[model samples]
Target: MGREFIAYIPGQKDINGQFTKANLGRTLGLLKKLLKGGLYEFGTLTAAYNGWAKGSPEYDQWMAEVAVYPTTAQNVIRDAVVNALTHVKGSNDDPIPLTIVWEGGPEGVTSRYEAAGPSWTVTITGYPPPAKSMLAERRDKKPS
Candidate 1:
């Protein structure tokens, strides 16, 4: 099977900003909100939109027929988001993909994800989670 691009689930979906999940940025519309919006947690929004090259529906479907690689996921998201943000703000600040990670400690603690670029590898190291769930939250724009 192929690895597909998807959002990293940080916590929950309805828990306000506490919960996090991966968002599929298949369109410029989604990128606008991510850039103008405040990123939850450390780099939730940043990583969520670092590359903005998340594959399109047609491309993704074709890849599924062949294979998928989340590594490429970040690229798609980053490109799209950056373009959207640039068009919106008329500025530039390239960030990496949203690696919504949760590190568990004995005393009810969790660590933020790394800010390294696409080249660096992220690994969760620490105490086992008593109960944890990181999820991505991507939604289509509301009809206007």
Candidate 2:
């Protein structure tokens, strides 16, 4: 089974201080460019819009699914996220928040700008759940 992770990247704003689709695209593009040659593979990229109906929200975000080897370490994932954020933010002072959630569990990393510079928090409290067995599922199902 392939281990897939999701990257949630906040959208950037334009000169007018507004979150435009163009800016969001640019942000995703930059992230993709920076994440190249990493220890993982890119899946698909999508946009997530958080509006009033969804609750209190500021702007939309981009979601990218990344597939990594089962043996990949948490540090490797954290480094990829940090590198992407560093390149995307560039000289911009605004803080860019990026999060990567591993499949099967809550293990993940959250990257953000701090007073000392870029920083990331890793959470690996538990191991990922084992993959479901097809035979087990078949046995549980009743024959028609």
Candidate 3:
């Protein structure tokens, strides 16, 4: 079975404030590869793009809540997303930072992930539903 989900990419533009079409394309492409590479399954996956024109929303509703499978699938997807986004190059051959925000799951897991040149940060939270579902959120990290 598959699940629906959403993913957000922060700072949609290059350092110069110009739209980075290649960066966006590469990031989404990497995610697609993960989906096709047997990492997990997704239904209702959508990317809320921030266009270069005026009145473009700045980073909040970058994505929406959707579904995802395996419950633990996020960790795998995060690892790949961070790796791929960090490596994405601009027209000037510079690396770009990617901050991905995702929400949705059986228990509603929400995550905000970011990775820059040599550093990365990932935070994921799963909720306990008022009503039980077939899947439970996975929390493997110890409290800091």
Candidate 4:
């Protein structure tokens, strides 16, 4: 069976330090692509796929709601991602920093993962993405 999970991408701020419509749109678009692919990996971990909650009205509702209000939608998404991550044997350890990418522009956010009952969820808190050096260190050094 495919594992189910939700990924929350925070809206990037504009020049006035506000989350404008464009930022929200980009975040939503990224989320949509993530959901459609249904798979991801962190660091050296093998690939993992998202699971389906199967006949869950709340799950269905939450999925529908995420695109409209990113902030309010975090809790629901966190539940799903946590549930899915639980199925994996190991954790990413440094989930937030590790997930951030430093290519082109900044995809800034701190990811918070939580697991409860049969749900897995992740929340993306707005922050700067990792610096190039930090990412390089993460890639070069072994976990201690």
Candidate 5:
């Protein structure tokens, strides 16, 4: 026998089927919401993830754990950045202005000239692969 060709795995599917841009977009939007609500901390997300509902133990716990509000923090940082950016000069002696803003949430508007602080910007792309079973199910389903 030369090379062996294996059959499909039980719970693995191609990358197109599992995670999707829509899913990622929604997740990112949720993160932004959490951020604007002063819920940037990982613990806050964890609490929200665990479950967040009114009059429930999980919600209460999340509230307790989430101490900071993202809006306020972002505001303060933006103010400082704006003022500083206006003053920052390039090597040529020209002033180096800047701008930074969050894309969604109540703070939806962009702040003119620099962000509150140095931020780690990222562009997340693509979706995760689906499980084989899920793939099969999708394939089996009739077009609708």
Candidate 6:
């Protein structure tokens, strides 16, 4: 099976207290570009919420599953994914908090990009093995 990751963008509100569509559009556009390489496919966008307590601002957080070809190198995929998500900026050109959970599992590496840092911080776990090409798999399976 191919590898997949979950990308998350925390809901952001503008000065008028409305969820900013521009931010969402910009992020989606970047992701679309990343998919142009033919190695990635973006899943449907899902609405997620946070801070459900009383008087807490509730907004629409967007989550999407990005699937990558199993033959691609892990580091290459990670860099491309992180680069695309981290480039998304708010209306005021501020960094937006974004996250990607590699392999779409609890045990996968969870990389987070916060406004407080200039790079993605892996707060979860270690990296998975580099994917092997179909040809390589077949070659290895051949009688030695």
**TM-score, one value per model:** 0.23, 0.21, 0.23, 0.19, 0.23, 0.23
**Candidate number that wins on TM-score, 1 or 4:** 1
The digit string of per-residue lDDT tens for model 2 on 108-132 reads 4433434453434333333442223
| Clash number for each model | 37, 0, 5, 16, 10, 0
Report, for every candidate in turn, its global Cα lDDT versus the true structure.
Answer: 0.32, 0.33, 0.34, 0.30, 0.34, 0.34
Worst 10 residues of 6 by lDDT: 10-19
The whole-model C-alpha lDDT of candidate 5 against the native structure comes to: 0.34
Task: Tell me how many residue pairs clash in candidate 3.
Answer: 5
**Given candidate 3, what's the lDDT at residue 140?**
20
Prediction RMSDs, each to the true structure: 15.8, 15.5, 15.9, 18.6, 17.0, 16.4
Candidate 3 per-residue lDDT, tens place, 1-144, comes to: 122111222221222121133454554554454464544333212232223222233222332222323446555544544454445445533334443333344443333434433433332335321111112222223354
Model 5: per-residue lDDT, tens digit, 4-98?
Answer: 10112222322112123233333344444566443354433333433444555544543442333355544444343323322333553122322
- Which stretches in model 1 have alpha-carbon errors above 4 Å? 1-28, 34-95, 106-144
Give the range of the ten consecutive residues with the poorest summed lDDT in model 2: 56-65
The CA lDDT at 82 in model 6 is 39
lDDT score for residue 30 of model 3: 40
Q: Which portions of model 5 show Cα errors greater than 4 Å?
A: 1-26, 29-47, 68-144
In candidate 6, residue 85 scores what lDDT?
Answer: 48
lDDT of 2 at 106: 50
TM-score of 1: 0.23
